[model samples]
Target: MLIDTHVHLNVQAFDEDRHEVIQRARENGISHMINVGFNRETIPSSIALAEQYDFIYSTVGWHPTDAKDMTPDDLEWIESLCRHEKVVAIGEIGLDYYWDTSPKDVQARVFREQIRLARKLGMPIVIHNRDAHHDVVQILREEKAAEVGGVMHCYSGSWETAKMCLDMNFYISFGGPVTFKNAKQPKEVLEKVPLDRLLIETDAPYLAPHPYRGKRNESSYVRLVAETAAQIKGISLEELAGITSRNAISIFGIK
Candidate 1:
């Protein structure tokens, strides 16, 4: 079975057919999906989705874009969620300089706080870095996030940078970008990832892979990602699914 390590089924983009989308993913062999909560608006729905679907899990944290509005109360609330049986990790948190919505300092502070929270809770994290790879990796090291480890969700970096992240106790996760025709970075980095450290995700409702690029994405599309990763690694699709699913299980602590 395949595991979609990242998704956004809680977003309004799937409000009308969330159940249908989930059903289709199951039909297509997606065994588990970690629906991510990026901001205040999405967290409740993300938790609800995990409660509603047995195969669904949740990751809660502040997105870097939402860093400007973060408050101590939000951190406490997120911490409270660690007790939830379905709460797998602390994140979708990190740096996102491409948007520039929040000051870099604010983003780093919030990211480090969540990293500490995850480490305290003895939970792994899910990271999001876009055009801020250097700062993200540095902060992870400075904050000692290696204590809990984590996945670099939808990783967009060079093999060298990925090596740095991996060395700093992070798994390199690839998503739709790996299937894009012009995604030379991910394509090249995929081979560099240790087979056991590699993970796959669809990041549904965003970054849909080829043939469905620009279209709303869903968990079922993870098959395309696994297929592409298999080709890049010269392994069978089943092998890719087994390896990535195992990686996801290891990170998320799925039983």
Candidate 2:
């Protein structure tokens, strides 16, 4: 069965037909999904979604863009949420220089605190780095994030960056952008990244793959990502799906 390593089902985009979307994904062979909480407000909502769905799990932490609003109490709240039964990781966190919503220093501080939290709780992480590769890699190393290895969600970095993350025992996740016709870098990274170090996601209601690009994404569309990787790695689609699913189970400790 396939697993979407990162999704945002808690967002309002799926409110209208969330149940049907999930059912369709199950029918399409998606057995599990990891819903990521992006900020202080989304954590409870994300956890709620996980509790409601047997196959859904969640990750809680502030996204880089939302880091500006985080406070001491917010960190404590997130720490508390990490103790929830269905919360498996601390993330959708990291650096995003592409947007100026949060100051760089604030994002780094929040990112480091969350990394420490994940380590303290013995949970993995879900990183979101955008155009801040150097600092992100440096911070992860300095923070000893390898202790709570995680996935670099929607990875859009170079092979060198991916190799560094892999060396730190982190899984490299590819999303819808990998399927775009002009996505040369991700395609190269997909080919170079060892299958064992790979995970696939849709980041639903966000980046839908080609043909489905510009439309709302869903877990079922993860098949397109698997197909893309298969073509790049010269493997069968079934083999790609099986390996990626196994990798997800291994990383997230999902049953």
Candidate 3:
């Protein structure tokens, strides 16, 4: 079975037919989905989904875009939710220089703090990086994030940089971009990454794969990503699913 390691079922995009969306994912052979919450607002929704479905899991943290808005009380609340039975990781957290929603300094500070929190709680992290690779990896190293390894969601970097992340005990995950006709880097990176360290996601209601590109993404489309990864790796679809599923279990500590 395929496991979508990163998705956002908590957002408004799926509020109309969230159940249908999840049902479709299961119908498409997706066995599990991690609904990631990157801000205080979405955290409750993420936890709610996890509470509702046995196969759904939750993650809580502030996105770098919202980093400046986080407070000590909010961090404490996130730590509190860590005790929830289905909260599997602290993430969707990291740096996003493209949006510059938060100042670089603030982004770095919050990202580092979350990494420390994950280490303290002995939980893996779910990273979100874009255009800030240098500082993101540097902070990860400084924070000793490898002590509680995590996944680099929608990884956007060269194989060399990916190797650095792998050395730091991180798995490189790919999403819809790999299916784009002109996506050269991700395809190359997919081929270079070792099977054990590879993972796939849809980032649902966001980066849907081709044919569904630019449309509202859903978890079921992870099969498209799986197809792309399998084709790139020259493996059968079932083989890719089994490998990625095991990798997800290893990182998320899912049962």
Candidate 4:
């Protein structure tokens, strides 16, 4: 069985055939999927999807791009959702300097607040680091994020940055990008990440892997990622699947 450690099936991209897409994932051997909801609109939809599917789980958090829009009420809402059995973590939260939709300071503060919330609730986080790797690692360090740990969602940073995250007790997650031929850094990093701390994902409707690159992505495509990861790790596909699925389950506290 395979588990998609991170996905965005809750978003509008799958509104036309979300169930069909999920079924495809199941048929493709995806035993479970973690649907990440980063903001107000997606969070409830994510939880609803989780409640409907026994194999699906949800994570609640605010995206850095929308940092300017988040208020105290939103933070409270995320905290309340943490009590939901289907909500496994607080995340998809972190610095996104690429978009810069929100000011740097605002993003940093909001990121810190959610990290503190995750720490308080004793839940792992799902980080989204973009061009702000330095600031993201710095803030994570200052906030002592190691106490709770997390997954660096769709990690695109260098091995140096990834090593820092690993040191902070975070798992390094790879997605469709790792399947690309020119994705040298991610492949190299994936090779170096310990099997127990390594995870694979599709980041559906976003980073579609090669052969499906530039096309809309779905969870079913995670098999391609697993195959590439297995090849990179020099293990059988089944072994890689088992290893990554266990890593996802362990980090997310999946029951």
Candidate 5:
């Protein structure tokens, strides 16, 4: 069985055919999906989806792009939801220098706060890093995120930077980008990541894999991702699926 370690089924992109999309994922051997809820809009929707589906789980936190709007009350709200049986981790939270939506300092502070929150709750985190690898690593180091190691979702950094995250116990999760023809860096990084510390995701409604690139993505397309990862790892699709599923289970503490 395969596990989509990161996804966003709670978002509006799937509103029309949400159930159909989920059914297709199950039909395609997707066993579990970790749906991330960042910011005010998605958290409640994410929790609702998890409650409605046995195989679905949720992660809650503030995205770096929406860092400026994350109030103290919002943090408290996220903390409260972490107690839910289906709430697995504390994120999709990190730096997003590419967007430049929130100030760099605000993003860093928010990232550090969520990391501290994860540490306090003894929960893993799901990170979303975009064009801020240096500060992302620095803040994670300063915040001691290694204690409750998590995932670098849709990882797109140099092998050197990946090594740093690996040292901190973070799994390197590859998504649709790794399947693209020109994605040399992600492919090379995927090849070098230790099997036990490797993961796969769809990040559905975004970053669709090859043959489906620039289109709306869904969990069912994770098979394409697995195929590419298996080739890169020189393993069978079944073996890669089992390995990545197990890694997802281990990190999320999903029973």
Candidate 6:
């Protein structure tokens, strides 16, 4: 079975046929999916999605891009939401220099605060890092994020950076980019990351894998990521799926 460790099923893109999309994923062997809420607005939607679907879980936090609109009270509200049983982690949080939506300092402060909140709640985190890799790594270390281990969702970094996160006990997740013909960095990281520390995701409604690139992605396409990892590690598809699913279970505490 496959577990899509990161997905945005609550996004508007899936509004018309969300249920069908989920059913298709299940039919394709995706047993579980973690829907991430990256801002205050989406938090309730994420929780509702998780409540509506047995296999869907939610993670609530402010994405770096949404940091500009957040206030201290908003952070407190997010902390309150984390108490939900269906909420598995505190994230899609971290730094994102790829977009200048929020100032770097503000993003960093919000990210650190969210990390601290996750630690206080004794929950893991789902980190989203972009061009701010170095700063993200530094902040995570300073915050001692190792206490509440999590996954670096849709990881796109060098082997050295991945090792830094692994040392902090973060699982390395790969998405569509891993299957891109020109994705040398992610491919290299995939090979370097140990099977036990690796997880697969589609970041659905976003990063579609090869043959489906530039199209709307879904949890069902996670199989392509598994197949790609199998080829990279010289393992059978079944073995790859088993290992990665086990890794997902370990990280998310899902059955």
Top lDDT: which candidate number?
Answer: 5
Each model's backbone clash number:
0, 0, 0, 0, 0, 0
lDDT of each: 0.92, 0.92, 0.93, 0.94, 0.95, 0.93
The lowest-lDDT stretch of 10 consecutive residues in candidate 1 is 162-171
RMSD of candidate 3 to true structure, Å: 0.7
Worst 10 residues of 2 by lDDT: 36-45
Model 1 residue pairs with clashes: none
Q: How much is the lDDT of residue 32 in candidate 4?
A: 98
Cα lDDT of model 6 by residue, 1-255, tens digit = 999999999999999999999999999999999999988678899999999988999999999998989999999999999888888899999999988899999999999999999889899999999997899999999999999989999999889999999999899999998999999989988999999999999998998999999999999999999999999999999999999999988888885
Q: What's model 5's lDDT at 220?
A: 94
User: Which regions of candidate 5 deviate over 4 angstroms?
Assistant: none
Q: Which ten residues in a row have the lowest lDDT in candidate 3?
A: 100-109
**How would you encode candidate 3's per-residue C-alpha lDDT over 1-255 as one tens digit per residue?**
999999999899988998999999999999999999889799999999899999999999999999999998989999999999999999989999899678999888899888989999999999999898888889999999999999999987999889989999999999999999999999999999999999999998998889898999999999999999999999999999999999999889898
User: Candidate 6, residue 154: CA error in Å?
Assistant: 0.7
Per-residue lDDT, model 5, residue 213, is 100
* Candidate 5: residue 145 Cα off by (Å): 0.4
lDDT of 5 by residue, 197-251 (tens): 9999999999999999999999999999999999999999999999999999999
Local error of candidate 3 at residue 61 (angstroms): 0.8
- CA shift at 174, candidate 1, in angstroms? 0.8
In angstroms, how far off is 246's CA in candidate 6? 1.0
lDDT of 1 by residue, 9-107 (tens): 988899899899999999999999999987888888899999999999999999999999999999999999878999999998999989968998999
Q: lDDT for model 3, on a 0 to 1 scale? A: 0.93
Q: How would you encode candidate 2's per-residue C-alpha lDDT over 97-177 as one tens digit per residue? A: 999899999999999999999889898999999999999999999999999899999999999999999998899999999
